[model samples]
Target: MTGSRKSADALGEAETIALRVLGFIASTEDLFDVFVNASGVSADHVPTLAEDPEFLAAVLDFLLMDDRWVIDFAKAEGIAPEVVMQARAGLPGGDLPNWT
Candidate 1:
């Protein structure tokens, strides 16, 4: 079905974006250390964890916590900052129900 195909494409795009974010984080020592500490994920295990959509969502969550980080990342990746949020939404468990 077209809908399912679209969903799969979205998932693939999200995963690619998340992997880019992971690379961005790993690009700097300070950022990498902070992410590893905050995530409680061993540096050696990042490759394994990167395969999980939930973990990728968390990576986006972490990136969203700081506007400067988002700007910098977006600029570095030559993408609009809004794309990060869109990618996050495409990931698993990204649709949190609104309580309002």
Candidate 2:
């Protein structure tokens, strides 16, 4: 397949996953809080992620690595792309990595 086609396919999958993650988040406050607190991310991040599927999935992956079920749900569903990019971009400013 062409590069653009491949990119589009990947993005479509990411969007599906991101929507699932958002649905899960709305259902589970525990998971939502876990992601927000553990990620050290703000609610403002949501709108950005909603607009960008790939970034959302990346953010969910980041949150899930903590090994908490609450976070795992987000990873399973996938998050939007921009949120992940923004959150990851901000990590270097933190005293310690979020993974820890």
Candidate 3:
């Protein structure tokens, strides 16, 4: 699904996606734990990292690692399932699978 030009043109879709992803993590303990563990960001510093787009992309990337999480987040957030990939691509590295 195409995102609104207004949202995309404003602060950027990455920001919206990041915030929503963070919200998703906030609502789920296990997901938050996994993000904290995998991201290696101290629990106390998560708020700071949450302000970082790269880090937010990492959050989305983490979700991208699992189809279930992607689907779940989509359903829960009421966003298009395609938003995940768009958000993933909005990150620093885009959404290409790592072969290295």
Best by the lDDT measure: 1
lDDT of 2 by residue, 1-100 (tens): 9998976675665565555656676567676676677667687877666666445655546444554543456365464334433343333232244564
TM-score of 2: 0.52
Give the per-residue lDDT of model 1 (tens digit) for 29-64: 599899999999999999999999999999998998
TM-score, predicted candidate 3 vs. hidden true structure? 0.80
Number of the candidate with higher lDDT, 2 or 3 = 3
Better of 1 and 3 by lDDT: 1
**What's the true lDDT of residue 27 in model 3?**
83
What lDDT score goes with residue 98 in model 3? 65
Off-target runs (Cα >4 Å) in candidate 2 are: 66-100
TM-score of each: 0.93, 0.52, 0.80
Considering only N, C-alpha and C atoms within 3 Å, which residue pairs clash in candidate 3?
none
Which structure is stronger by TM-score: 2 or 3? 3
